[model samples]
Target: MILLGERQILKVVRFATIGAYLGDEDDQVLLPKKYVPSTLCIDDEIDVFIYRDSKDRLVATTEKPKLTLGTIALLKVSQITDIGAFMDWGLEKDLLLPFREQTIKVEEGNEYMVGLYIDKSDRLCATMHTYEILSGESPYDVDDMVEGMIYSIKKDVGIFVAVDRRYHGMLPISEALRIYKRGDMIKARVVEKDEEGKLKLSLRLKPLEQIDKDSYTILKEIEKQGGFLALNDSSEPDEIRKQLSMSKKSFKKGLGRLLREEKVELKEDGISLKKL
Candidate 1:
């Protein structure tokens, strides 16, 4: 069977003005004349990538696409049409990313990570829903800093990442102070190896800024408890974990920042939100 969106070697069964017809007796796709090699003859085998043309006809090419089925790549948008956005994927026909499959409002000339798939009409298309499509086997350990692209956003879940543009990784909502948008470049560290082997990433990698992340968590918790947390730096480690879900050392560091910033005040009993 001919596999769309993948490279395969096929036989040159016949010749035509348009190009060579490649495949066995069951199926054939035209390898356009411009891409045809010199001294090529009937029954010669050539490696080719298969995709449909603008006319929706299956065609073969010697050129490789930046992405293929079940995998992802960062592609640049060429233009935006009413139907979808077109991207340059190193093919004669610009790849189509239909609006419905987009995770965000794509702007012309912006790059987005997308995966290839065959649509319902049997046409090749690109999609931004790549959370499950990314490869999970990554060479990273806990606290190893890595850079990636934010490929998808799962509301109330987390930020889906493509580390080094291939491995599956994610930043949980609790690990962030703000929501990261799709197509955003991410520089973070691996915090845990998830049960499924995917990387659980965290942005609190730098020692200098690590307090910021913990401090934000404390501020939110204090505000959630009506501007007061009975747990303070003097509190026991178990109490800090029970009340704030953080270590006592982290609590002290974050509390110190809040005190320095005057967002909260240390009191005789506990920490209180400073009045505006």
Candidate 2:
């Protein structure tokens, strides 16, 4: 059976006119001219995405998709109007992002990582605020390490995150040690639940002592690599954390200890082992 507003892998079954209707089931949905891929034949299985047209009519398309329906996608804003902004979703018509539907009005040429869905009007739309769509049980718990896409930031409040795009979490101000703006992806930890029941997240992991078992592994890498590692202070905090999984303060402390013992020499570019 063919499902509306969904992509289905269907066998061509037969050939039809430019505006001819076709479907595997009796519903016999219309395959508009725009949806037809060049030169097709029967019994050939092809992937097609289905959606309602401007007139609220069912239609199909073979356009390379940015995302499947019901799933969230980071789309680019193509145009903006007083009414709304249109996002390029690899379709003949751009998806509408109504003003009321947006967390913030996005300007053209900007990209917004958003959750896409069909609104009450059956029109495809997007929203930066996805708490309503992502509220529920998390496949994670306190102290659990997780990675997420930075969708948006509410200044002074924190950043909104979609953990693996399946769970909801927030990086609070106190624990956001590093400066991060929207679209800056990050690694975080599930810290606790807020009074409002939202997930309280922390960008900083627990103290290194908490990862005692892994400390030996890290120390070994430092030793094998010559007791020293060079890193530019100009590197973004997020990038540094990605490389070392530790905050700048924590990393500096460790480096200082190694240098004080003459185990390593701080160089102009980075750190290197002291040659006796």
Identify the candidate with maximal lDDT.
1
lDDT of each residue in 179-245, candidate 1, tens digit only? 4677678899998987667998987656667788889989999899999988776798878877776
Q: What TM-score do all the candidates reach, one by one?
A: 0.56, 0.61
| lDDT comparing candidate 1 with the true structure | 0.86
For model 1, the stretches where C-alpha displacement exceeds 4 angstroms are: 135-276
lDDT of prediction 2: 0.68
- Candidate 1 has what TM-score? 0.56
lDDT of 2 by residue, 158-251 (tens): 7888776646778876566556766566777788965544567876557665344233333555677666554645556676567666666666
Give model 1's clash tally: 0
**Cα RMSD (angstroms) for every candidate in the order listed:** 11.1, 6.3
Query: Per-residue error at 256 for model 1, in Å?
Result: 32
